[model samples]
Target: MKNDEGEESRVLLENYRVLLKKALDYLWERIKVERREVKKGKRVITKVKVTLSKKEEVYKSLRDELEEVNVLASHYVDKAISDAYSVLRSWRRRAEKGKASLRKPKLKRVYVRVKSTLRKVEGESVRITVRPYEYITFSWSHTWFSPRVKGLELGEPVIKEDKVHLPFRHRLPWFTPLDYLAIDSNLYTLDAYDGEKFVTFSLRELYSLKFGMELKRGRIKSFASKHGRKGGKLMEKYSHRERNRVRDYVHKFVNKLLEMYPVTTFAIKKLNKQEMFQDADDKLSKRISRTVWRSIHRVLKYKAPLYGSLVKEVNPHLTSKSCPRCGRVSRKAGLSGVRGVGSPWTGN
Candidate 1:
């Protein structure tokens, strides 16, 4: 049922996956060896000066090792090594931030990064080189996004098993902001103060959806104990459904807020989740989980660049109790009947 070109594409994808995985495994092994050496050195001194091997040296070694064993083009090996380094760098960063696991990182997804040297683009089509002379051409001439990306610049492409993802970047000029929209996120509401008036976006529906899903999952746990496989699938389905629905709601809510105050700098509270949950009770933790304040902040941060706006995370200390009019922290201050003193955005 499949054509020759489709079959060839499938085979190429598989081969690229295998080759990329092999290179990543070798790089991870080398990283573990380096980590072991560092640990051994630290055991000898109270404050050991540790220095790992340079990235360029590791990259050169990886490229040389991969080239000697694989028959792929040199650029493929280069891109794979680059991706491996990216992974390694990300792991090191997360480890420093106490966000990564103690175990070494593993290759979770198989994909090839196609650099500019491995791809040629013109008009609506891109020709990607798979090997020395072989190529795969992709075109979006008939699709809706074709017209949208007419003048945008194309960056590196990623080749996955089922599809190739093309990244298009648009360069926009920066502008001076006219005003600030200060937003305070709570369990059931998002309050916005736009330097003049206040607006409240009720998050009752979002909270209700999450709370209902949590109850459903709780009830299914009993069924899961009896019927393992089928109940596990049900649990996964509901979990994914909850995640997707929450994501959709957050995106839409953030988009609406951004649209309301376009080109303005938005301010939000910088919340520390770990500190918040340190002494929180079961009910409080569930309420905090349903609020999903971080998702709102993250979506706003990333999407603000596109809207010519900026996002600033202000300190949460005494924010709700601070008077916006006189710039005074009061024990009984609220959001109503506050006149202008100075912009809260300036102090933050």
Candidate 2:
């Protein structure tokens, strides 16, 4: 009896995995076919008519095919169609800018998007419909997630590996201003000026960790060239570790800063990263690319409301070059020249 139950569970999981792969393949094929039609002048890629018509065709085709693959739901098929178009759109944008080589989207991994209608939350467990009259329930012990889960409306869940990730949406309360902190985000540190007082958070350690990871990656690559697939896995493992470490550090740092200050408003410079890094040197550009400034800004913006704070983007033009006191732009006082605390104008 135990062996029979275990075998049934394994089969059910395998069926879901197979369905996900088929969905991915079906979407990719549709995209390729549409692209060929566009090139042959049989179809026009318009914002409304053509786009809607193509999507309808793809959705209908998938729906028809899902009769054979009975385990996959219609809503999940629709989501896959949307995901395929999203990938194509992104690729088209990059190709237009000559930033990437044009190629069809590949399915290296399986992702199944499950709508809320197909999943039910019962106590600590979520019952998901895998097929008609077939369901699977997953339980969790994380009590901390219960309150957040109850508060917000949950979006479609994404299934990857053995775990399901649920996305939630909620409205945040508006902040009433008490004080503003003007922050200048740089490569080495975040320089913050709250009218009379100035504070700097050093990010040198983050950069150091990044550089160390890069060094390790280089060594791993060299070994991979000689030792085959095992070395490649090692490289991927280290790369993932490095990314998680940086993300964790940034989250902690931002949380601490917001807690310490308790400011009502945050003023940060609007960063145009692409334009800024276009002409920069290779090494410096790589370092800047790994800094995760955008991630930090996103974290700050989202988390600020929880503390009754609002984030604002100020114009970055001549922010560092111009002296705050005299309002004069100094061409000679570059980033290197503006070292060590106090006013850049006074050079203290």
Query: Of the candidates shown, which would achieve the greatest lDDT relative to the real structure?
Result: 1
- Superposed model 2: Cα runs more than 4 Å off: 1-74, 93-100, 130-134, 141-156, 166-182, 193-198, 211-245, 261-274, 282-290, 298-348
**TM-scores for the candidates:** 0.70, 0.59
Q: lDDT by residue for model 2 over 161-221, one digit each (tens)? A: 5456766666666657788787777777888776676677888888788888888888989
RMSD values, in order shown? 6.9, 8.5
Lowest-sum lDDT 10-residue window in model 2: 339-348
Q: Mind giving the per-residue lDDT tens digits that candidate 1 earns over 269-294?
A: 88877666655787777677667889
lDDT of 2 at 47: 26
